[model samples]
Target: MTVQNILSIPPYHYVHVLDLNSNVQTLVLGPKSYVCKEHERFTCEPKRMISLSPTEYCVIRNPVVTENGVPVVDSDGQVRLRMGECEYRFHQDSFPLYPNEEMSGGVEVLPVVLADSALRLKARCDHVDTDGTERKAGDEWLFEGPGEQTGSSSHINCSSVRCTEISRSRLLQCFIDYLQFETRGIHIFAIKNLSIF
Candidate 1:
């Protein structure tokens, strides 16, 4: 067998890939254990594998909707999904399952839950906000809960916040912040919902 075949993931499994735009796509492996993206077939890379417990987790590809509640469609005639935000779900039984192996249940609404842990993400490329704020690559950020957070001006019910990482250190500085809160007698909930992107 070729290198691609040898390194391919098993059939019916899924691989989550993060593009430069910060969008995560769940590509399903075909029967041949290859992923087809934009007409290109390739093997799944090790870094793209997201370890999720099948019993407790599910993925939701929520559609990108406008302020008026209209769904946004891409030039390719496909509905643009908010892949970055709806990648992981804490509950698997919230939605009905498909008859077969599918990465997501298509576009549907699900109740957002306060996760046990926040998701840590790394920027792959430079991005600019609508307000002209520029974010550089290698910057780490956190996407936290459906609950309230204090002492942060940019807090939203569930949103991304810029976080700092110690240079040359693979450790996340956010965890240190949480530990500090704990030491100060602040009750920090256990973060079992943590996912790295």
Candidate 2:
């Protein structure tokens, strides 16, 4: 599907499955899933963000497909490697995973690599399959645009990005359905730990 328009979304929480490989998939994180489902980890919510600790935190360790110039390990290809998860750093921000070859349609994921940092931020809207459930794990997750770019592998060293193009519902959905939280509730600790200029 090609994206003609994108909307801005507010953050919420849900349990999302990370399609690791063709046959094997892993449940990454979701606020709703953790509280309701049985997992090996403990979680807590701080402010609008959900933090995940390692008790039940697990990385699927799988291969990935790249979109535009960014490479993400998610079903959509936009991801942030957890802080301690890899040698390369992925921020604790909301991320999307997009399929490959989507820079041609009307809708596209826009990513900006900062001039002073290695950080990358991605923002996209639904263009193809509206059926999130029916879309399956491997289906392409984007629209198309002439000059627009797909999301990034893992957003890096950056702090903020304009999420105005993404819908509030979409943003909430990603958080409720996609984040693996070490802890949920007020992210007082996370916020306190931030680097202040």
- lDDT (CA) per prediction: 0.39, 0.29
List TM-scores for all candidates, in order.
Answer: 0.24, 0.16
Tens digit of per-residue lDDT, candidate 2, span 9-36 = 2344422232333332233333332322
The prediction achieving the highest TM-score against the true structure is 1
Instruction: Count clashes in each candidate, considering only residues at least 3 apart in sequence or on different chains.
Output: 1, 53
Q: Write the per-residue lDDT of candidate 1 for residues 37-142, one digit (tens) a residue.
A: 4433333353222333333444544425335645555564444555444344442322321112234643323323355545444445576634465556544445
Model 2 C-alpha RMSD to native = 24.0
Distance (Å) between predicted and true CA of 196, model 2? 44
